[model samples]
Target: MKLASYADGSRDGHLVVVSRDLTQAHYATGIATRLQQVLDDWGFLAPQLEDLAVQLNHGKLRHAFAFEPEKCVAPLPRAYGWAVVDVEGSVRREAGQFQGPHQPLRAPAACEPALAVITGDLAAASDAAAALDALRLLTLAVDWRLDGDLIATHCAPLAVTPDELGEAWGGGRLQARLVALHNGAKLDPRDVAAVPGDALARLARLRALRAGQLAGVSLGALELPLAPGDSLRLDLKSADGQHSLFGAIDLDLAPPPALP
Candidate 1:
């Protein structure tokens, strides 16, 4: 079952259950008003939302409307923490080119699964899976800069979950394709990499994650330099290409005003 937070003219958008095909949606007002609320009480709310999802799939719910990606915000707008775990052995192998001016940051040799703590606000997406059991979505990691200085490692602003990808978590490989674009012109594509499950296991041991805190494990190393207006997109597909995840974020020099 796919879930999303959509704009309803409110600061924290309304929660909605999206159909498998991404065509229709039903407001989850009966379950929760916002996505963060549901995450806060996932133990109780997930089952209820799952039940609503079943009802929508069976055509039992009324008031359903067409779903729109453009009318959506990051699934969790604001999270307490955002950390990306690097896949072991995959990082150095995937660092295709060193585009940044400074020496490329390397994962410490002692750190089994190197982790980076993202500071400031991070863009969220309903499509990317936060936990091992969470629904999986494609995540795009953008190399962002502010006033000509690299501010964050990556900014994932948008993500989409497709129904074709069954709810299968753990013990499998996830292939990722990293593409960099400047003014719509494609840059040299990076080496494709497969994220193994052991990396996630290492992260679970290292981070004492709270209920809704997001853990973004990098599938591979990012070696692209993005300037203002440039963008990075990551497309992940299952081995069979049956299920896929995608996300993109444009670079902005001056950070957006923080929300009150």
Candidate 2:
């Protein structure tokens, strides 16, 4: 069970509750029986939970709580459908992958580490707004870093309708661009396009390209780990808002730190 507490920085009235399972974020209904079992086992406090409501909004469980904070215990809604659950369930050291209720994580296959931005359709209606919102959500970049570098900075548009986007952007086209900034110079954009039908095949090619480049780096691979403060900047946009995630890995090798 995962747990967190929040207060107005006060020692009293702090709310503490255990998050019983990962599936609760996806299909709280599917885990309904199990959830009851877990809560029951926790003793008297478990039964005290009433006004429990379920969330269908999407994203993490927080959405569930947000929908009706007072009336019930809401299960996390199935929001933008992006999840990066750790294998050990410890929420530490794991790869990132985009998952929708009906879509399998294997659709994109997790190999290189990644950061995924999930914006709903209203987001696409305002590309500039979506881009800025995506940036704000991406402060969690360190959680998605791999190989001492971030494999890809990406996005997933949700909620907003296609017609809404078309009305705003004047076309059915949306895009996210991530530039590699080195020594104050921005490198040309790398390809991370998400297309239909052969998207899987094309993504395979992109991964191959990354591997080949990483192998050939003359400075040797950046085996160093990223410090907590390290991060990469990414830009993203979408037209339909209902689309696959966008991502790109860094192939450039950073110069070694200066010697004393």
Candidate 3:
């Protein structure tokens, strides 16, 4: 089932269930209000959301609305545990809020295309197999690695269940290529080999652990420099390389706020 969060003048926007074709949506008002809430009660809430997704996809809902990509915030506006491991292998806490794909970004030095993994409760010292089982959703993300430090992140509009990935997901990593476009031009597609198990293990190893905490993991390799007024699109394709797996994360980088 595909899920998106629409901007609603709140830190955690309104939750909506998106259609399979990415054309329509319906507010998940009665089922669950926030993505984090669902994550916190995955066993009970996900199946309900999945049922809604099915109904929306099949045109069974009467109040469904057009899915607006531009009005979304990060699937999880603020993750329970969001962090990135630097080149030196140190887990740096990326505590800032995540921007939605269409959200204007304060022009950064560069953007790195990546596959982000959002997980459910995971036990510490979990192996790859265990870690893989804990993964719940997958989405596209653009990372800003400033001087090797994680500065900011822009997440795609929708987050898909791992089952949506089909064969692309295996061995605790996304075995697929990430396509990146900069300034309306296609850059080299990056073959992703980022193992979430490795990253999560590191996170558990370095700090005291918590159960049922949701963490967004980014493992990107392609970096493209940018300036204000530049635009970017990051996408992942199906294993057959025919269509987009998660919808493209399209961003129009905006300049930073002026001095007061």
Between prediction 1 and prediction 2, the one with superior lDDT is: 1
Residue-wise C-alpha lDDT for candidate 2, range 62-155, written one tens digit per residue? 5344211111111111222233323222112223332211111111111232232222122222333332322211111112234344343222
Q: Which ten-residue region of model 2 has the weakest summed lDDT?
A: 211-220
lDDT of 2 at 194: 24
Candidate 3 residue 176 Cα shift, in angstroms, is: 2.1
Model with the higher TM-score, candidate 2 or 3: 3
**Candidate 2 stretches greater than 4 Å from native:** 1-176, 180-185, 196-228, 237-260
Backbone-clash count (model 3): 1
Off by over 4 Å in 1: 9-11, 87-164, 167-172, 176-207, 221-234, 240-243, 246-260
Strongest candidate by lDDT: 3
Residues 59-143 of candidate 3 have per-residue lDDT tens digits of 9999999988888998887886666664456665666468888766665655655566777877767776766677788787777
Quote the RMSD, in angstroms, for model 3: 2.7
lDDT of 3: 0.75
Each candidate: what lDDT? 0.46, 0.25, 0.75
Quote the lDDT for 187 in model 1: 62
> Tell me, what's the RMSD of every candidate?
10.1, 16.8, 2.7
lDDT of 3 at 202: 71
For residues 83-163, write the lDDT of model 1, one tens digit per residue.
455444322112111111111222211111112221221123221233334423334443333443433443232333323
